[model samples]
Target: MTKNNAQKKAARLHQAANRGTPFPSAMRAVDTRLPAAVPGTPWFRERKRRLVCYCCGHPNLIASFGDEREDTARFELYCENSGCDAREIAVIALSGNMIGTSSRADVRTLTHFPQSATSHRTVNGRYDDWLAGSEPWVRTQRGEDFPCLWCGEMDSRLSQNDVATDRSRFHLRCLNTSCVVREYAVLIVRDGTLGTADRPDVMAIQYIDTPPSSRRTPGDASYDFVAMQRVLDEDDKLARRRSTGPIDWSAATRIR
Candidate 1:
């Protein structure tokens, strides 16, 4: 098909997919290029305000905005790998009066766009050195090594060995051949008189890709810390329940 026809077909396929229709073949036929970066788009402005590289704290480009109100605002971010050509695209929304700040870190977490599926491979360039002195954390326990959270690979190494602040944690890259996913988690420690102890009570999972539409933006709604707390509390309960067994029920609920 002609390029213009393919673009139109892709747009239609996306609309169909959003409406719960199955159009995989049609979607695959059309090229899914990164939406043109516009200087004055709302999503671009929002990214300029809130989007930052989790590793280097560098700002990302506003890749695209939704043609409709409910569709997510898509963005592209560069990775910290100086030798890797991988970029991270995230989707975000406003929660309260704030446009980019959200109380629940994981509520609007990443939804990765496959690297192989994109038109361009990310260029390895050192624009920032956020994880300059960080250590790599790998999965080497007994039994089966947990899949690297970021790239879905079996060889994801931690970007930081020691986390100083609550937000200064590290991420793991996925090892799956075609998936360029990045996963982030935090290690919390309980404060006591003598010394603080590590607490597995809280764990946050951040995506290396775009966040879901429901979570990208902030609105005028009051910051519902209590509601957010409830979500976290339930998450903790679920984790505890799962830790008692070998089967991980959490992975089952991931959005496909």
Candidate 2:
């Protein structure tokens, strides 16, 4: 090809390469304040609002937090397009006690909070049992399928699921990971209180050493239990820092 043609082809290839690259993921900012509507009162209304999808930017869906209670609100937003199962969903449970709202009008104020960008680690399926049964802080029941509090992924139907106390919850798998063998803790914050044992809320991460005898992958043969332990241990430390307000080194380190 001629020099001019070669240059044009190179330019086209560069443009195509850039187009193929995926965009970075982002999280929405969470507001921890309750709305003005009382749970039992007639004035209390669960409103669903629509916004342009951050991924496709198509103004085709409505999303909002389910409702506001005494000092907490469970908010969920997802794509409305039936054809688009992009899984671009966010579920946020905010605490309102720390930040006071003057009235219901104030509660309407919304912000785009960012989620943690860190890539998730993998764990074993055996640990999944411990998470669902033993961990009280990270469990949520949905019909027969139990979803994890941290990532909201469901547990295996074959495995028996368990429940925890009102304060904490957990799930067997990390939806963000590929192996489907990771566990996550779901910590609920009450009234925006931080660091205090009474008000402290957190989600812990843990992994198992050996793969289940039922199934194993080529990658599983090389799994390192020690590394997994360190990761969980570090995650626990980071969870403590995140629950506290200071935003210390531990919190800053584990987060991507």
Candidate 3:
């Protein structure tokens, strides 16, 4: 987008930002990439405001957005809870170049992007640095911000033996004794946002699983009838010879 057109988009979005302006110091937050930096004006930080559906608080996929070009972004937030399928549109303008700073180094760098995702959290990189950067890590070297999904325990601590290589992995363990949490990796929940003990807007880890005794649909011929018959036959054989103990109905619990 041209600098002039970018400026117009910023202006319109600026109005929305002004309405919900956060009470922080104003700072320009985009790389204009212009030939020369503008001087003598104080930089106005880009304002961020999210529009989610009132019916449902969370949206399904942010993977879709409109005009996601450089300067301004217009996007639709979709919520799919209980087949509601509600949507809320959102707009935000990015400011390029600090108003008064002649050099880029003089202004605070603002990174505008979401965190990357991975199929497995066990991969190695500076992600350890990011995951370990939570408030709990600084205060007590724990992973309270991104708790272990298995144990639901947040006493996360880094491995003591990591050599600190770029691709070297950062391992975390849950402190719970009865739980099965161990050395595992982390997942980025939010990029460019620091999570604290009070607010955990950072990385996390979760495990997905299914029980082996999951129920199948009734009258479904796709099931293994031979295996079911074999089990029934085995039970018949056991019933013929079993006299070791009497039935104890009180010890058994009903599924329903």
Compared with the true structure, what per-residue lDDT tens digits does model 2 show for residues 1-256? Answer: 5754544455455546666321110000111232444323111123334544322335543443322222222223445554332222322322222222212211211111112211222221442211111222122233344433223344321112223232222223333343222332222221112211221122111011111222233445543344554443223221221232332223212211
Better of 2 and 3 by TM-score: 2
Location of the lowest summed lDDT over 10 successive residues in candidate 2: 22-31
lDDT of 3 by residue, 1-256 (tens): 6655665456456555776322110112222543353332111112222222222233332323321222111122333333222222221111222232211110111111122222222222442322223221222433333333333345545544322331112334546565433443322222222221111111100000011122233454454334544343222221111112332222111111
Clashes of 1: 33
C-alpha lDDT (0 to 100) for residue 7 of candidate 2: 44
lDDT value for candidate 1? 0.30
Relative to the true structure, how large is the alpha-carbon lDDT of every model?
0.30, 0.27, 0.27
lDDT of 1 by residue, 1-256 (tens): 6757766676576767667433332343354653343223333233333333343334432233321222222222334445222233332321222222333333233221111111112222365232222221222222233333222235533334223322222333333455333333422111111111211121123311112222222342533334554343223321221122332214323332
Which candidate achieves the best lDDT against the true structure?
A: 1
Error of 3 at 102 (Å): 55
